[model samples]
Target chain A: MLSINDIHVQVDDKPILNGITLTVNPGEVHAIMGPNGSGKSTLSNVLAGRPGYQVTAGSIRYQGQDLLTMKPEERARAGLFLAFQYPVEIPGVSNIYLLKAALNALRKSRGQTEVDAMDFLALVKSKIKTVNLDESFLYRGINEGFSGGEKKRNEILQMAILEPLLCILDETDSGLDIDALKQVADGVNALRTPERSFILVTHYQRLLDYVQPDQVHVLAGGRIVRTGGPELALELEAKGYGWIEHLPRETGP
Target chain B: MNHSLTLDTRLHDRIPHLPGHRLDWMNQFRQERLAAFTTTDPGGKQDKQWHLSAAAAADATDPPHLDPAWLERYRLPDVFSLVWVDGVFCPHYCVREGLPAGVCLKSLDELSDAELTELRPDLTQPGLQEADALMNWNLAWLQSGAFLRIPERVHLEKPVQLLCITTAPVGLVSLRHVIRLGRNSRATLIHTQTGQAGASGTTGETTAIWLEQAAVLAHYSLQTQPATARHFARLDVATDTGACFHQHHLALGAARALTDIQIRAADQVSCELNGLFYADGNRQTAIYTRVQQAGSQGITRETYRGIATDKAHGVFEGLLQLQPGVRKITATLQNRNLLLSPQAQIDSRPQLEINAEDVQCSHGVTVGQLDEDAVFFLVSRGLSEAEARTLLSFAFANEIIGKIPLTACRDQARQAFLAALPQADIHQDWL
Candidate 1:
C-alpha cells in the first residue's frame, strides 16, 4: 500500500498541501479531484518530491518504506514515478536517449544489465506502435517543440517505459483530446497489475470513465475534504466545487 | 612602442631563400612587411595575448623547442608530415609522387627556386603589420616549410597532414605555412602542432597559414599539448572570388594556448568556420576570430565552444564585418562557453560591423555554466552528475565536431573531449 500521513507541504512560503492524508492499496487507483486553486497539482508535486516543495511535516510510506527519505531519482528507482504537469523540452537530446537512459538507470538499480542500442531500439519501437507516435519523435530532442497533446502523450510514453510501482500522474489529461486521452488511458490500462498502484490527479470525471479509479477524494484548501467510491468523481463533476466552497472553512486545511 | 615594425632584414634573408615571382607587386609586398613590422606598435595592442613579445614576458617558463626524439610519438598515420621544430626543420620528409596531377606538395627546403620566388612577396603583403611579424618571426627561426600547391581545377582524394612538432628547449618556437589551392581546386589539410611529449614546465608555439582563390579547403588544426605547455597560433586566411573555405580549430589542452583565426572573403565567396576549446586543470586558452566579407554576396558562419573547469580560463572574441558595397552578405557569429568550477572563468565577445543596410548579419555570445535545470533534470533521470554534465557539454560541441568530414579526426575530438572531464568531482554527492 502507498500512504501519505498528514503531509504538510509549502511552496515559496505559502502552504499548499496542508496536512493531507491519502492511501491506495495494490490494484487500487485513487482519483484526486479539486477546484483550480485548491492545490490539486500541489499534492501531486509534493508526493513526487519535486524540487522547491518544502515538506515541513509528513511521512509518506510506500510498501512499508519511508518514501520521503529517497531522492527523486532514488524514489524513482524504488518504483515511484510522477508524470509531470509540464514536461520540459530538452533540446538536442533525443527522446530515444531519454527513454533508454531512464530504463537503463532503473535497470541498474534493480541489479540488472543495461539494454544495448539494438535491444533498446526494439523495445521503443514496440512501445511506439502503442502510442502511435512517429519514429521521428524518437530522434527529435526530448519534447522540444512538441505540441501540447504530443507532450502529454510523451509523458504517458515515459510512464509506459519506466513501469513504476506507484505512479502519481499530475494532470495528465489537461491538454489531451478525446483520441489522445483514450490512447493514453489505453496505454496506462495495458500496464495495470495487482502489484502496482496509481494516484491520478485530475479536476474532471471525464478521464475516470476510462481509468475507473477505485476511490475518489476531494482536496479543498490543501486538505482532503471529501472521500467516496468511484461515483464521487461523477457527482463532483456534475455539481462542481462550488457546493464544497460554501461548506464550513473549519472543515479542511 | 612607436618603432616601425620592419621585416626588411628578415625578408631580405628569407626572399633570397624562398621561391616566388619577380613581379613589381612582389617588391611592394616585401617593403610592406618591413614597413608594417617597423612602423606598427606591435606592443601597444595590449588586449588579448596576440602580442608575440608580450606573452613571452608574462610567461616565466622557457618557451617550446623542436625535440625530434619527443616528436616521434606525435606523428599522424598515412599522411605527409613536416615541421619547423624549435624553429629548425629536422628529419624533413615529403612525398613528391601519387599527388593529383598539377598538385604540388613539398617543404620549403624541397621547393624549387622559381616556386619559392612566387610565394615570397605575398608572404608579406601590405596592411599586414602583425601578420608580417608572424611571418618574420617564422622566417627568423624557420628550419623548413611544408608547402602544398594545387593547380587550377585539381581535386585531391586524400588529405595532406602538416605536423609542426615543437619542444621547449629555449624560449618560443614560431612557424609559418602557405597552402595555396588554385582556381576551382579542392583539397583539405590537417595542420597539427603538438608539444614534445616530455617537456619543461611549459612552452609557447605560434604558427601562421593562408589559403587563396577559388580554393575549396578544409583547414583543421588541433593542439592537445600538456596543461604545462603554452601555445599561441594565428591563422589568417584571405579567400579570392567564389572561393569556399572552412576551418576547424580544436584546442582541448595546453597549459596556455591563445589562438586567433581570421577569414576574409573576396566577393561572392562563402566560408564556414567552427572551433572547440576545452581546458581542464589550471589550463588557460584564449581565442579571437573575425570573418570580413570583402566582396558582394559573401556569406560566413562562425561558432566557438569552450568547456572549462578547475580554475581554467577561456576567452573568445569574435568579429563579423560586412563592409560597404558587400551587399547581400549574410554573416553569423556565436561564442558559447561553459564553466564547470567556481573559479573557471570565460570572457566571450561576439561583434558585428555592418556598413551595408541590405546585409543580414547577427552575432551572439554566452558565457555560462551548465544549465542548472538541465543538470537537475538529467540527475533526476538517474544520470550521475558527471555523466549529465559531460553529456550536456558534448551535446554543446556536437554541432561543431559533427561537421568534421574526416572520420578519424572527428573521432579523436570526441574521445579527447570525454576524457578531459573530471571524474572524482561528479560522484561526490551521489552517495
Candidate 2:
C-alpha cells in the first residue's frame, strides 16, 4: 500500500531522515520506534505531505501514485491521515463543525453527496463514544482548554470519524495516561480493516502493549537500524534501544 | 449646495434650516459645535493619529422607496423599532407596539422645546464632549435621531431597536441618539446602520448614553454599509455608581469607517466593551475606544478583534485611564488582529494611563497572520487551502462575535460578518 525508497528528508536545510527505506502492505501496522530527535515524526510528516519538510532524495509511493506530488489537502482527501503529536488548539472552530467540513470535503473529492445532518451527527455521537469524550466537547472550540489526555483522545475521535485509508499516529501515545492509551488503542484497533494501513510513530513501547503491530522498526541516526517482528518491541523495551544503537543500517527490501 | 465645499462650511450655510434652529440654546449649541469642527483640522496628516480621511457628505435628497422585504431583513421580531431612511425618520415604518408604560421613545424632531431644554445639560456634558472633528460635525448637523428613556425602577422587557437605512444615492445621512436609563432600570438597545448597494455616501452618527445608579444597559451597534460609503460613529457613555454597561460594536462594512467610543465609569460600576472590525478590498475600518474609571472600585474590560484582507486597512486604538484616588479598580484590555493578505495592514495600539494605586490593570495586543500550523491542521483534514483560511479567519473574528449578548442580534452580526469574509461561500453548517 505504501513504499518509501531511499528517502532523505531535510527541514530548514538540516537533514532529519537520511537514506530511509521501508514498505508496508495493506492491513499492515508498522511501529516506528526511536529516541528523541531521531526523525520518527519527520517520516510521518513527510508521508502526510506536510510543508517545510523537504524530501531531498528518494521517492514515496502511496497506492501506486507519487505521494510527494500531492498537496497536504490532496493527500488528506486521498485518505492519508496524520494524527499530530501536539495537536493545535483552534479557538472559535468547533470540533463537530470541523469534522463535518472535513468529512464533506473528502466525500466531495470522491464525487459523493454531502453527509446528511442527522446522519453526520449520529455518526459523530457514536464515534465520540469510542474516545470517551462527552457530547459537549463537539460544540466547544477544537481542543480549546482541553486537558492533555483529552486532546489526544480528540485526535482519535477525528480519526474514527474520517476513516482514512492510511493513518499515521505521530507520537499519539505520548502525554496520554494508561487509560487514555487503551482507549486510543481500542479506537485504532476498531478502525483497522484488511485494506487499511497504519504507521505508529512512537518513542515508548507502552502503546505497543495495547495495539499490537505487525512489524517493529528501530530507527537511529536518521536511518532504520533494524526491522523485525512484533517481538522486536519487547526486546527494545527490555534493552532500551542502547543495544541496537550501534547496529548497522538496513540497505532496503 | 456645492458638494466640494468643506463640511464645516456646508453646515454653516445650513444651520438656519436645521431642526431646532429657532431655539436660542439649540442655535448656540450648533454654532459652537460648527466652530469647533472648523477649527479642528480634518486629520489625515502624518502627525495625526487618524489613518483615514473623512468622506465629504453628499447633498441630502429625497429617499428612495424601500422594499418591504429589504426592510424586514434588518428588523428584529417583537421589539419596539424606529426606522430611519436617509437620515429622516419614517413613522410609517416605526414599530412601537407593546411599548411598556413609563418608557419614552421619540424622534429628535418630535421632542418639545421643554424636553430639549431639560436635556440640554446631558447634550453638552463636558465629559461626553471630545475635540473630535467628526463628532463635533455630527452635533453640528444633528437633525434626525431617537431619544429613549426608561423610568426609574422599571425593567423594560422588550428591546428597542434603532434601524437606520440609507438609500439616497450618494447622499449624507446624519443621526444622533440619546439613551437614558433611570436608577435600577434595565434595557437593551440595538442600533443597526446599513446602506443599500446603490447608496454610497457619508454617514455620521453620535450616541450619548446615561446610566443611573444600579442601572443595567446592554447596547449593540452593528454598522454594515455599502462598499463605497463612509461611516463615522461616536458613542459617549457615562454611568452612575454601581451601574453596569455592556457595549458591543461590530464594524463589518463601509469603504472607510471609523467608530469612536468613550466611557466614564462611576464608583463600583462595571463596564465591558466588545468590538470586531473587518475590512476587505481596499476598505478601511477603524475603532478608537477610550474608557475612564472616574470613581473608586470600578471595573472595566475591553476586547477587540480586527481582520483585514486584500489591501484593506484596519486600526484599533484603545486607551484606559484610571483616575486618581480610584482604588481597587480592575481594568483589562485585549486587542487581537489578523492580516489575511500580504498587502493587508492592521494597526493596534492599547494604552493605559493609571494615576491610582491599588488597581489591577493589564493590556495586550497581538497582530499576526493566520496561524500556519492551524491552517495546516485544517487543510490536512481535506479542506482546500482557501477553505481552511476562510474557516480560520472566521474563527478569529468569532472570538468577539460570539460575545454578543442578544441571540437575534448576534445571529445578524454573525451572518453579516461571515458574508464580509473572503470566500464566504463555505457551507454554513461548518460555521
Candidate 3:
C-alpha cells in the first residue's frame, strides 16, 4: 500500500535520513526500531507530510498517488495518519469538538454526508471505551492537562474514530505504563484490517510484546541495517542496539 | 492650532441643547467637567500607542430608525432589559416588568431630585481622574444612561440587561451609568453596546459601580460597534469590606476602541477581572486595567487575552498595586495575546507595585503567534489550513469567553467573537 524508494531526508540543511527505502503491503505492520538520533520519528513525520522535513531525493507512492505532492491535510484526507511523539496541548479546542470536526472534514473529502450529532456521540462513546477514557474527557480541552498516558490513549481514541488507512505511530509507547501500553496495543490490533497498513515507530521492543509486527527493521545511521520476522524484536531485545549499530547496512528490499 | 481647544469650542456650541442642560446642579457639574477637560494637557502625544483622534467627536442629531432584528440579536432571554437608542432610553424597547422589590432601574433623567441627591456621592466619585479628556468629555456631554440600585439584603434573581445602540451616522453618544449595590445585596448586570452600520462617530461611556459591605456584583460588558465607529469606555469600581466583584469585558469591534477599568478593594474583598479583545483589519483595541488593594486579606485576579489579525493593533496594560499596611494580600495578573499576521501587533504590559509586607503578587505577559505545532496537529486531522487557523484563533479567544458565568451571556459573547473573527466559517456548535 505504500512504497518509499531510496528517500534522502534533511532538516535545516542537515542530512538525517540518507538513502533509506522501505515498503509495506496492505494489512502489514512494520516495527521500525532505532536508538537516539536514528531518524525514526523523522521518517514518520516525513511520511505524514510534516513541514520542515525536506526529502532531497526520493519518491513516495501511496495507493498509486504521489504522496510528496499532497498537502498535509490532503494526505490526511487520503487516509494518512501520524500519531505525534509529543501531542500538542490545544487549550481552547475541546477534544470532542476537534474529533467531530476532523471526522466531518474527512467524510466531506470522501463525498459522504455529515454524521448526525446523536450518531456521532454514540460512535465517540463506543470508541472512547477502547482507549479507556471517561466521557467527561471529551468536554475538556484537547490534551490541555492530560497525563502522558492519557495523551497517548487520546491519540489512539482519535485513530479509532478516524479509521485512517495507513497509521504511522511515532513513539506512542514511550511514556506509557504497562496498562496503557496494553490498551494502546489492543486498540491498534483491533483496527487491523486487510485494507489497512501500520508503521509502528518505537525506541524499545516492549510495545511489540503486545502488538506483534509482521516485519522488524533495525534502523541505524539513517538506514535499515537489519530486517527479519517478528522474532527479530526478541533478538534485538536480547542483544541491545549496540550490536545492531555495527552490522552492515542491508541492501535488500 | 490646539486640537483640545478646537474640541472644546465645538462641544461648547452644543452644550445648550444637551440633556439636563436646564437642571441647576447638573448644569453646574457639566460646566465644571467641561472646564477640566479643556484645561487638561492630554499628554502622551509621543506615545505611539495613543492613536485616538480628536476629530472623532461630532454633533449628534436625531438618529435613524433602528432595525428590530438587529436589536434582537443582542437581546438576552428572560431578563429585565433597558434599551438605549442614540444615547436616549427607549421605553418601547425597555423590559421594565417583573422587577423585584427594592430594585431600582431607571434612566438618569428619570431620577427624582431625592434619588439624584442620594446618588450624588457615587456619581461624583474619584475614578479615572488621569483620563481627564475622556472622563470629563463624557460628563460634559452626558446624553442619557441607566442607574441600577439594589437595596440592602436583597438578592436579584434575574440579571438586568443594559443594551445601548448607536444609530447616528456621524455624532457622539456620551453615556454615564451608576450602579450601587447595597450592603449584603447581590446582582448581575449584562451591559452591551452595539452600533448600526455606518454609525461612524464616537461613543463615550463611563460606568461607576459601588459595592457596600458584603455586596456581590457580577458585570459583563460586551462592545460590538460598527467598524467605522470609535468607542471609549471607562469603568470604576469600589468594594467595601468583604464585597466581591467579578467583571468580564469583551471588546470585539470599532476602528479605534479603548476601555479603562479601575478597581479598589477594601478589607477581605475579592475581585476578579477577565477580558478578551479581538481586533482585525485596521482596528485598534486597547484595554487598561488597574486594581488597588487597600485593605488586609484582599484577593484579586486579573486575566486578559487579545487577538490581532491583519494590520490590527491590540494593547493590554494591567497594573496591580498593594497598599502599605495591607497584609496577607494575594493578587495575580496575566495577559496573553495572539498575533495572527506579520503586520498585526500587540503590546502587553503587566505591572505590579507591592508595598505591603507578607503580600504575594505575580504578573505574566505573553505575546505570540498561534502555536504552529497545534496548527499542524489540527491540519493533519484533515481540516483545511484555513479551517484550522480559524478554529485555533477561536479557541485562543474562547479561553476568556468561556469564563463568563452565565450561559446565555457566554453564548452571546461567543457569537459576537465568532462574527468578528476573520475567515470564521466554523460553526459554533462544532466548537
By lDDT, who's the top model here?
3
Q: How far out, in Å, is residue A167 in model 3?
A: 0.8
Candidate 3's DockQ: 0.84
Model 3 DockQ class: high
The window of 10 residues in a row where model 1 chain B has the poorest summed lDDT is B422-431
Quote the lDDT for B28 in model 2.
81
Per-model DockQ against the true two-chain complex: 0.28, 0.83, 0.84
Q: How accurate is candidate 1 locally (lDDT)?
A: 0.70
Q: Who wins the DockQ comparison? A: 3
Q: Quick one: ranking by lDDT, best first?
A: 3, 2, 1
Cα deviation of B99, candidate 3, in Å: 1.1
Residue range B212-310, candidate 2, lDDT tens digits: 999999898999998988888888888999999998999999888888888989999999999999999999898998898999888899999998989
> Model 3 shows how many backbone clashes?
0
lDDT of 3 by residue, B49-106 (tens): 2224434566677654778888898899998989988787787888989888878999
Candidate 3 yields a Cα-based lDDT of: 0.88
State the displacement of the C-alpha of residue A61, model 3, in Å, after optimal TM-score superposition.
0.5
Worst ten in a row by lDDT for model 3 chain B: B45-54
* CA error at residue A146 for candidate 3, angstroms: 1.0
Can you write out model 3's per-residue Cα lDDT over A1-253, one digit (the tens) per residue? Answer: 8999899999999999987889999999999998889999999999988889999998999989999999999999999999989999988889999999999999999999998999999999999998899998999999989999999999999999999999999999998999999999999999999989999999999999998899999899898998998898899889889988878888637
Give a tens-digit lDDT track for model 2, residues A1-253.
8999999999999999999999989999999998888899899889877889999999999988999999999999999999999999998878899999999999999999999999999999999998889999999999999988899999989899999999999999998889989989999999999999999999999999988899999899899999988898988888897777788888755
